[model samples]
Target chain A: MALSTSSAITLNINGEKHTLPVDHRTTLLDALREHLDLTGTKKGCDQGQCGACTVLIDGRRAVSCLQLAIASEGRVITTIEGVADGERLHPVQQAFLDLDGYQCGYCTPGQICSAIAMIEEHAAGWPSAATADVRPEAGAPPLTADEIRERMSGNLCRCGAYVSIVQAVAQAAEAEAAQTPTTARQFSGPSGPGDLAHPAGTTDAEMTA
Target chain B: MREFGYQRVFDVPGAVARLGADPDARYLGGGTNLVDLMKAGVERPALLIDVRELPLDGIETTDDGGLRIGATVTNSDLAAHPEVRRRYPALAQAVLAGASGQLRNMATVGGNLLQRTRCGYFADLAKPCNKRVPGSGCPAIEGEHHNHAILGASEHCVAIHPSDMGVALAAFDAVISYETADGPGELPLAEFYLPVGDTPHLETALPSGALITGVTLPPTPVAAVSRYRKVRERASYAFAIGSIAAALDVQDGVVREVRLALGAVASRPWRAQEAERVLTGGPASADAFAAAADAELAAAKTLPHNGYKVTLMRNLVVAMLTELTEEAAR
Candidate 1:
């Protein structure tokens, strides 16, 4: 007997239950954009090469194009549409708007989603290839331009808006850090102690002034 | 994409049983490569058993202070694990040096180790690839052959393994744990990947219906100070043209112990055992490092387009060893 190829799966996306009948071959990106009408998550490369289809699956950023809709049934998915608090824009979105972090804005949703998780990963002391030290004792590396570029390398901007994107990500990271002040989470950065919380090219004096 | 049945399995035995029942069912993990292959029409499995939710997603310590990493453990979690970062720095570095953060968050350890080559010919259905379709023909041998293999390749195939984590695992002597139809089994990382003699299609020695459960990393003290360096076209998000994974244990200016492996050079991770043999008990100097690298790469047979890999591998070995030596001094 042939098994059923399509099923009605309820996906927990953006704190709402989305029950949709989809073919087994339908990717999560297609389901969100076409079926559920959540076009905030863009699809650049149907393959995994481009990160324009990035979303947060269970609090971690992942490319949705490679994920099948049926497989994402029980997972908690967060898209760019759910990033804001009703009308209040997320800090990442606000930073991007303020700093012109995008040119064509095709990759904005993915860039914002990736930057949001990256800040949290950095706060949790996850080291990147650009980090000077990978030891636990090193705490978190200072969020430098090089570090932002490395962490957000997945989401590509075809319009060459990397300079502003890097600046916007840095600003959002600092804004989030200011809201939640933790002591042990201090970064024993490569630079002096004065540049501990501040990102590279932005000084403590500038932040205060 | 073709229609396929998707089933999510919760246990290892059930997964194995289901796969054994179907003749063309594939075990999907992260779907980073498999889904792409399906989209490209390279793979068309009738049923895809989703093993991501299986109970094989833990990284625990063994009685011998070694680490047993579950197959479903994501690359991001593996790279961020405290024990992995402190004990097996090279493994973590290798994982971090690979694909972007999004891919790593979804990619599993077993999937990364089992991923296929990124050869254009292999992915192109129109082109003839010996690995993709045995006995067809290898177009890459004469066209765009610069990134082909430099060692352990035949006229049949010349595609290099596109895994940075496997290089470090090869250096540390990792063991692959799997559950077969008969019973559970283990294969050392060295023997897990079969040699590319005549058949490039048969990549691993894994049984027909075996399911990889986890990877057991033996306790090696030298691993604490190891490093993985990949030379890619870009600084990140690109496959390696040449890479090295090295761990050096120097005592009083002499090479007490060393572990070495080269990536993107052959069908499998090229463990530099000959280099280790030459570096043992020798002075930890630049000259000694260079000589040891040459010794390991002496038997390398390279194609006309890939001859530069021999030099690239040699320089990478020396440079990584020298950097480790300097760090050991301080």
Candidate 2:
């Protein structure tokens, strides 16, 4: 057996840049878990069938297993690790905990990451298969049960916590809609390219309240 | 996964040149399909030319009133485009029906077009699959073939092209544009896929090192009335058992034009030209629709477990056509 050749690449993970040598065949999921040690993003299925490796690439939800680490250079990648503000939990994470959105907790990271992007997508007036009357005049589609299920169909929980997961997403959406300034401020602070600094000292209790 | 060299091509010429230079090099789009195949050990490319960053992600209107969708356009963007939703509803619906939202966001048009079969035998490394290795013998012909092809399958392979988008593209008579070492050229989507003859390994009509640039859909009024109907075991995230992409243009109780295509029933997207011919200039009635569907599926040669697909395809065609005709009447 011979050692595989490696390539030097810089990956910006969880609001920090790390330069590492990775094999050419290393997927973004492997690079995160094996190389960078960000095990928050679980690998449910090495194939793209399962969404356990879900992450935000340039603010869009993508399956990390399907993305090559070399092809993902220069993009902003937000994992489950980056969803919190210092010691503070993101609203979605708080909602998940408050609602007990997981039983086994294996698929929780992907569910949370996917739900965050799903909320932003709906708020931006994107429609899902469950969305009837997709015209703008129809207004922002409500986060109904059907809408939640359809939008989050990618992330599967074998433990059958789907009902609780949907409830958590709805709660988070409702909280975000309430425009709680402190909670909103954490997410609104510099989440684009070249913005690596995390917000300081926001707490989980403050976000939940 | 086997160790491989990677190259990122910035231009079409560079991509063609690199691919032409290396016989074992495969072009990478979103890696949603190729990576999975590589992991399965079914594909062992020595070099991968990453074409995701190429300047071919645009979705623009052609000068002739058609639409030119770049090959690299993500499935999510293509499905959600306002023009697609308004004009080509079936195409949009077909794309949405195929994959999850996250997968769609990462899958590109080119990658989706070149997606391999979901046949269990083809994906298994230990199994004998002619599609994986020519003349290795196909276990699917007698093995668990419940989801195998019902039409255009030879003795060597019974695999089906698992793309819902391909079926819709076939119905729309879309053209595939490609660039080769010589120059650029285009072929109708109907002529793009090769029949599953003795040589099951040869899938597409693309020349070696030819890079698919985009797909051009000609303007057709039938698009406004089209619908894509897929029947599967589950409500979501399941492959279609049998699907139909139908567009009916009925005027004054007469079917002025109709386009039909079947998915998950053939090795490639089966364009129902015979059905279209039967529906054109015919009465807009359930009887006529059923007759057209029967004519198209008349040649379907089904295996033991997949005999249901023939009936499923017939019902899907009739039901979609009936719905479109009634909508046009209203």
Residue B19's lDDT within candidate 1 is: 96
Return the clash pairs for model 1, or none: none
Q: Which has the greatest DockQ?
A: 1
TM-score of chain B of 2: 0.99
Regions of candidate 2 where Cα sits further than 4 Å from its true position: A1-4, A132-141, A178-209
Q: In candidate 2, list every pair of residues with a backbone clash.
A: none
Highest lDDT model number = 1
lDDT per residue, candidate 1, A1-209, as tens digits? 79678999999999999899999999999999999999999989889887999999988899999999999999999999999999999999999999999999999999999998888777767788877667565566788778888899999999999988988888888888787765445432212233223222434443233
- Candidate 1: segments with Cα more than 4 A from true spot: A183-209
TM-score (C-alpha, index-matched) for candidate 2: 0.92
**Chain A TM-score vs. truth, each candidate:** 0.87, 0.83
Interface RMSD in Å per candidate, to 1 decimal?
Answer: 5.2, 5.4
What is the lDDT for A152 in model 1? 90
Kindly list the per-residue Cα lDDT of model 2 for residues B14-80, writing each as its tens digit.
Answer: 9999899888889999888899999888889888999988999888888887899999988877876
Q: Clash totals for all models, in order?
A: 0, 0
